[model samples]
Target: MTLTPNEILALPKVVLHDHLDGGLRPSTLIELAAEIGHELPSTDPDELARIFSDNADAGDLVRYLEAFAHTTAVMQSADNLRRIAREAVVDLAADGVIYAELRYAPEQHVAGGLTLQQVVEAVQDGIEDGVSEALEAGHAIRAAAILDAMRHLDRSLEIAQLALDNRGRCCVAFDIAGPELGFPPAHHREAFQLLRENHMPVTIHAGEADGAASVGEALGLGSARRIGHGVRIHEDIDGFGTDEVSYGVIAQHALDQQIPLECCPTSNVQTGAAPSIADHPMHELRDLGFAVTINTDNRLVSGVTMSSEFGVLVEAGWTKEDLFEATLAAAWGAFLPYDERADLAESVIEGYGIDL
Candidate 1:
């Protein structure tokens, strides 16, 4: 059945792979930049908006990522980080995301002298505040925090420890992000081992800029429970399509492991991972039984939302039922406890008028 963009958005959703820095509101960036005297490419809100547009529309990951330098610059302060997280939750909730797990590299926040613990705790405070506000408005939104260690750096073990320390608190998982190709997950093997020993939930940014080997390494070395943008798994499939398609061992293993692949269509386009929304591997991944779920990797950098991602998928020929399944994939892959994840699945079924 057909569904309009607003209708698609109204169908309750889950966002498993979103970044706190990548989702800031533009006006928030302007205000925080002003308060901190940080020079910007464009101070005017309109110009700033256009700048964001150019970055995303440029279809270049490096250019799109440069925008985060400004955002992270302003967010170095605890108050700014808190406000960004709080506002991000409200925005995600308004977009009908029943649950969200926001990730960011804490080392980036130390520029303003806040300790790693302080940065994580501050974002946690913001998420709690946002969830409370949403609950007050009768929405009952749930939010979790994931600590991301920049892979190019040597702090993975420390960040993993931090997330584990806050595991049952506001924090839910640990991640490794940043440039991927040369800096393999093997670099962070010790950190992943530590997290695995603690039974901590883990997700890794894999297969976006890199290929299947990177994804294999994330699972093999990092022991990632979920793969962030495992789109490159498609590389293993040759001539896949028509009245039939095929899945290689790597792709099939991801399915077998039930490791959710966070497919951010728009962000993939901007990052050169996919040529366009229509070219995304989402359909291929899902059709092959891979746990593929939609996401907004960097909402502000990509200037999109969970709703917008769904809209793009629909525009690319996804059906209402397809969206329902994708939403279920996200809910099922959420880093919540087993009981909580089950509850989310039930809520999603109720929200989407579906079973299972």
Candidate 2:
């Protein structure tokens, strides 16, 4: 049966690349800005939402990123961070996301006199409250934290240590997120080394604004088990067709190592990584044996939901079986323990009424 939009929304989903500061509700943004005496482009929630969507659709990575300034500006205080985080979970649950790992840079939230640790704690508390409320509402949802360090900054090691210190408590993994062109994964080698020494999992933002070289550095130098938006790995493929598609070193390595690529369709299109959903490389990558998983990089900024992402893919010629496979891949690629991941995968398979 062809899956309708509502059917897709009702299906259990998994998300790995969502951003905390990038997914604030438009109404919440306006209210927070008012509390902090910050000026916004528009006071009307609908107009504010349009502004965010339009700014992010600029087709330039740098300009697309400018929209975050408004969202992060309102997320400085502990109360604001907590409220945003909690609401993020509630929102995800409503969209049928059973599991998610929301990432945010703690250093960005400390501008209002809050310490790094304080921001983490506040977000964690909010996540707990969100999970509890979702359960009360009969929506089973679970979320974990992934602490990201800005790649252009010098506090990567500090943030890595923070992630390790809170391992198994709130934080699940360490990530480096920011401008990926100039600041390659090698710039944060010390942080990666710290994570490696502590046996912590790491995911790097690569191959979005850059090329396959960035992805190679992420895997080899940074030891990333997963690549955030590794869409540019397409650049490394030698032959496009003719029965023998040759993979370059980076592409071959990613496929051979079974590293997961968190593919955010709408976000990638908005950032010009792909021209549109039809032109996305995820379908090719998946066919080539790369472990590709779907995600919502930013629900509000990209103006998407997990269900909407699935709908786009389906319109682009994907099948219900393809969506099921992507969800299963996300479950296995999650930062959870082996048993937990296995259980989640099993549940997803059952939810899809399919045998693995």
Q: Which candidate number has the best TM-score?
A: 2
Candidate achieving the largest lDDT: 2
Model 1 earns a TM-score of: 0.96
Cα distance off (Å), candidate 1, residue 235: 1.0
Clashing pairs in 1: none
- Across 1-356, the per-residue lDDT of candidate 2 in tens digits comes to 67887899889999999999889999999999998888988999999888777878877666677668889998888899989999999999999999999999999998899999999999999999999988898889999999999999999999999999898877999999988889987788889998999999999999998989999999999999999999999889987433578888889999888899999999999987777899799988887878999999988888888999999999988998899988999999999999999999988998889865
- lDDT tens digits, residues 114-223, model 1? 99989988999999999998888777789998899999999999888888888877588988999988898899889989998999988999999899888888888788
Query: Candidate 2 versus the native: TM-score?
Result: 0.98
Model 1 segments beyond 4 Å from truth?
Answer: 242-246
lDDT of 1: 0.86
